[model samples]
Target: MIAPMALARPSPQELWEMDRQHLLHPWTNFGPFEREGALVITRGEGCHLWDAEGRRYFDAVGGMWCTNVGLGRREMAAAMAEQAERLAFSNTFVDVTNDPSARLAARLADLAPGDLNRVHFTTGGSTAVDTAVRMVWYWQSCMGRPEKTDIVARDHSYHGATYLSQSVGKRPGDRVAEFRYKETGIHHLSAPNPYRRPEGMSEAQFCDALVAEFEALIVQVGADRIGGFIAEPIQASGGVIVPPQGYLRRMWEICQRHDILFIADEVVTAFGRLGHWFASEAEFGVVPDMITCAKGLTSGYVPLGAVIFSDRIWQAMAANGERWFTSGFTYSGHPVSCAVGLKNLEIIEREGLLENAARVGDYFLERLQALEALPLVGQVRGRRLMVCVENVADKATKAPLPDGVNESKRISDAAEAMGMMVRPLGHLNVMSPALTITEADVDFVAETLERAIRQVTDELVREGHRIG
Candidate 1:
């Protein structure tokens, strides 16, 4: 047989040109894309990434808050390869099953809190959330309550990118592209952002007000018209806005009273991100009716997402004799992805990553808290590894930096130049480093971020922004 043609390894310039020509990146600013092009990251290993030119940078964003096991794991690779060779693609449809998928479902059930045992695997977070929405509608329809079809979502909460999922999402910028489903039965409430609460209101008062608002909405909208409420334990994409104390629990109580299904979108907070397999009940003391999770499920090693629902949903379906859910994906529970998930879970357990996240994440936040002393830092807030540093023009007034200042972008650019990566969300810089991160890694991140913030402060002063 003739030897296989050798694979071509494109040079850095060639790679960059190819990306600029063909790749359409997500959440991209086209103007900047046309001007600067994308950074071609070639490889990653243990909380760090290397660009095409072989420059190393600390992955403070944890590969978009997913790479909990870090990167470049030989075991993860081996598991994927082995599963692919054994039984890579199998349709997990009616009368069909795969070993990895079944096993993982059981494992997740064991790990999940309460009766969140039924698992519906999807290709990624968006689809998982889409599935949850579909199920809510389906369940309501099946129960002969089609009128109770509206979904309640919080402002600035990110569920996913799918049409239905994005319809439920309320990020103002995310809606600028348009084409969202109009007449979609979705409602929104104010985000439980304590920092932005009305002046003279304590955090406890803010929490009470938010819960009251939720209850009032339910009453005003008529609970008979509401089917589900979806929220993130921590609004990850919305500048890591941590809800006030008792917010989630109180919301769940209202949902219970209103006969509404509560869906905790744990896409970013699950699977060791918050030092737990699931953060809904573990971190927030709320056992939601459903939890849509992805990201750290497979530690960014492969694409996999799941919706873990309570037995009430399962029982409803079971009680409906001969009625099929009639929803699934061609690659739902792909054996390779499931196998990788199993191995990822195994790695997390064996390596004690959960405990590591808890310990190191606390230290990391403590170190980042020091940055609040900086003039531009309005607040530093987070739990475990997920954190955000909000930039402000006036700290005492808590006024946001001028949009033209591009404060977060400037800080992210400065950090990148100094060998670190952080996500720039408007006026905030968000970070969710790998669970494998160490105290030393936290030190590096803190130092780099401090330097970046200081540099940006100087630039802002030079630009005459009059930051205080």
Candidate 2:
């Protein structure tokens, strides 16, 4: 077993120096960071966090948009430890499966919308999405349409990081933009960005135009050649771009009409993040063929993910002469992770955290919009705990700043100095806290955000940055 971390105290300066000298962080440039230090988070509970220096602050970002159930969960720790001590290693391959794996699969089947009764486990969101992509092509092959294997994903929609998942993700973080995965028949499409809609358009008209564009893409790609279409029901990482009303439903219908399998990448939006077990059923009134989920599944206590599929796809894949599904991970269904997932679900349901997200999320959304009066804030958009504040050059035109402005980074840095951590996607400041956050906590987030934006905007105005 890997050695446990020692309970030793270290100074912030020491830790930062160690990070600079030894650590290679992901998605980071180490050269510039060598001169400066890193922010070290020490502890968290409820909707708050403490830095290495013991400064308390509200966790507005919820640790990379996970931690839906909050932190310092003693019960979760106990559950994971108990499982680890028990049957810790068991392969879910061939005829071997653990009790927790079976039980958690059944629990998820019951909770999933429609007939997504078959659960395939993985270690995290990336692998789960990677598995889903492979499964779609495999299903197409099984159905005897090898050529119908194209995938269509929306702009700025984040699926995951594995090859196929990365290819499908049109998110700004997508480094694969210049590469052509189209050799494998994967395609990208545009989404209805309501905040930045074209001139002389109402929200309803914008949605209609979006629908028409989507239909045009399907036709242009040839409906017979497209195998699957995947999306995040709320587009969390894609600037929390919540669609206008009926947007999701319309997209799902278009997929159905084109005979394309619909997949929902619910890695961030599932398990009470959207005040529902799954956001698809709540917002779109339709269930997808497959739903890839991670993050809050075990509330970040343990690493786990799942690709839930309907019986139609499951049966078709199973009844074939091929015995193996041809895709999975060694720790796909780890016993400890399964046990933690079961416990996490129990806590979420027993404590009504989903309902809390609904109630508190409504309050947070209303208050977040109040920041629009500030010059830097263009539009505040999101649903439930997932929200984004778009930074614009001019509120009247809704135009984003020039690429050199980097308003997102400036505002985020200011928030951190104010003892809060926030991240930006494009020109939008993304915020998603614990589902258990209270109304007072929500207010604190709003007030702190106002302070951060005001500070940044004031500095920019004095510096002659076009924030107006």
Candidate 3:
């Protein structure tokens, strides 16, 4: 056994100095990081995390929506160590394969909906999405329709950071750096955000309008030139924007009639985050042609991602004879990562985490919904364990907080002081705790958020901001 080592640990000030001088984090402001440095989390166990200074805080965001099984599981650590000792590395190029990878693929095929039985492994969610888009283009080429290469994605949808994946993604904040493919044949459709829908329109009508807009785009762009329509069942990073009821099903129907492939980006929704292994068909009644998943596959114990596709695409490639489908990563089916993923899935099933998420998620969301009664809260929405709280200056108009308010960040900061952590996205605070969270944990989260928002609201009022 690889037991824990009792090495001398750095003090909080030393750690902060090291981080400030070295680490360059992702999606960081730089200005603030230069002044404040990183948070320097030291340890995590179950649903809580401890910083370098030994301060404990509730992990409400689940480690960027990936830690479905929480942290510090000895079984998961043991599985990883065992796999590394046995067979740490192997390339899945051509016919080469490993036992864990093959077994995990078969298991994922069984859990996936419809004929999505084929699996292509990658290092993480970005690469998984990149593989899915590449496969779509390759499938079109194999069908002898090379012109069908354009992809349709929705505004505010976050796919990944790879070139092809980023090209298809349409997040405004991600694009501010002006780094993107100049002409990637990617198109955007309106987001089906019910809270921002046209005034006086019912949810059903809003759904219809969004579908009609998609249809119009297809007609204008010509379905013959479009290869795929990629979407997240619930847009997590984009403020947890859940589409109107029946919206995903209707979109799938249109894609079916137009011969356009549908790719469900379930990176944040898969592996018990939404009370299921995959949420596409189970929650939304849509079996996409391809489903990209990662994050909770190993419950964030290790880095792993995969693209699960229907047999139709596999059969099409098989029909193309000896011509190779030549695209893969160096660590495609990494033995250690695959072993950890399999063990993670085993833990989730054995512990009844899925059932717990379903039962407790209802109470969680119900508690969050009650926060809408607060003056600064415009909306609280989510499904299962994934939820978002949108801040607004006026509930009557659904207007966002003032230009420089940064309400979400203020609330998050306050919540951290109150012993909880929540993700701040623009004017929204997002939360997706581990599947192991209980009703008692839910109560802590709700109470902490209420206090945080109330404190921020008071600050805004004193600062001369005209907030609700």
Candidate 4:
């Protein structure tokens, strides 16, 4: 029999005080953070995480929608170390390039769908999204269509946290007020939420209604004034909202017809999260003019992102001027990050994580759907590894619970106590476990979620909230 080994570490309270004193977390409401500090995750292995006190918990969100290959990868570390020993960094500016950057770019282009043949690297998802918006501006200006200035996004969309990307994404709270340049022309459409679909409509009809909504908005704003239509195949932070079938294709057709660039923000869905390298074309049957990806590109080992472009967009971009793009970061194509990305992709391919995601995603969704039997579960939905369990106030009317409802958070906390991690967003508990998660792992998540949901449901019932 093997005995557990103990290692000395700082006390949890000490670490918590240090984190609260120095670290400023993103998308956080710091009043509570000031009082409670943060969850100090010490390390991760496979689909599980260990906190500072060595409490094990399944990472149901894959470390904020990255970590497709899971955690504690020795080979990935070795790849980064090898690259650091050889060539750690280089400037991709001035036509300079490194082996890993060049090869990884080509590898991404080949894996991406359609004529998305060009790659522009960035530091991470936020930068990638901002870069895509800039590229759209550049593309339109090069084509002598400067009037196309407005970017069209949807409700519940999360592009990034950069200034431009914050304007591109929907609200998290009052964070938008801090920006000096107010969002003027960014248009937002209704979120494609099927669970809250209009009364008495089939899934296909709801899709048509949503498309019509977009068309009417375009007409209201005038197609000539629009620059691009940015969308996520699956809205991650937006309660894991999945649109009706054929919605993506129709939206693409409308964008093409209006001469507007189609930007697929696959920062969350790309790299096997949706059972493919890119879900826009592979799963949705439409090709985007541009796609911004990060997150799983290097599986969280290193920060990296890429702006993939179609031939049409690239041709317009190259014909603009000879004076270089005057964009990109010092670490845009850092050889070390790219080297890790190259090895990461090779690992994903060699281990067949994509295939695993496809096969297990169905099982995963099925497991979530089983929660519909619980009165507290309003709806269960998702694709592949990404799934959600929505707690409702009323199932007959599909009414949402009151704002500031804390049951979701409590349930998530309970799940963590049961050795599982989940993301709670507006009464929705979201899960996007690693692609490397097995069927047994799926069962573990499903069973733990059921227990947590029931515990919360019983409490809510006793409180007479009627949440179902």
TM-score for all models, in order of appearance: 0.98, 0.95, 0.97, 0.95
Q: Model 3 lDDT vs. the true structure? A: 0.92
Please give the lDDT score at residue 455 for candidate 4. 92
Name the weakest run of 10 consecutive residues (lDDT summed) in model 4: 1-10
In the predicted model 1, the residue pairs found to clash are none
The C-alpha RMSD in Å for every predicted model, in order, reads 2.0, 2.5, 2.8, 4.1
201-228: candidate 3 lDDT, tens digit per residue? 9999999999999989888989899999
Q: Give the distance in Å from residue 316's predicted Cα in candidate 1 to where it truly belongs.
A: 0.7
Off by over 4 Å in 2: 1-8, 176-184
lDDT of 4: 0.88
lDDT of 2 by residue, 1-468 (tens): 844436665578777777777877756645567777577778888778898788887788988778988899999999889998998889998778999999999999999999999999999999999888888888887887888888888887888777778778877756734565434577777776787678889999999988888788777878889999888888888788877888888888988887689999899999998899898887678689999999999888789999999999977777855757868889988999999999999999999999999999999899999999998998888987899999998988888888767778888888887877778767879999988899988888888889989988898888887776
Query: What lDDT is reached at residue 355 by model 4?
Result: 95
lDDT of 1 by residue, 86-118 (tens): 997999998899999999999999999998889
The runs of at least 3 residues in candidate 4 whose Cα sits more than 4 Å from the true structure, single-residue gaps closed, are 1-9, 171-181, 320-323
Q: After superposition, which runs of candidate 3 have C-alpha atoms over 4 Å from their true positions?
A: 1-8
Model 4 over residues 298-349: C-alpha lDDT tens digits?
9998999999998888887677356357689999999999999999899999
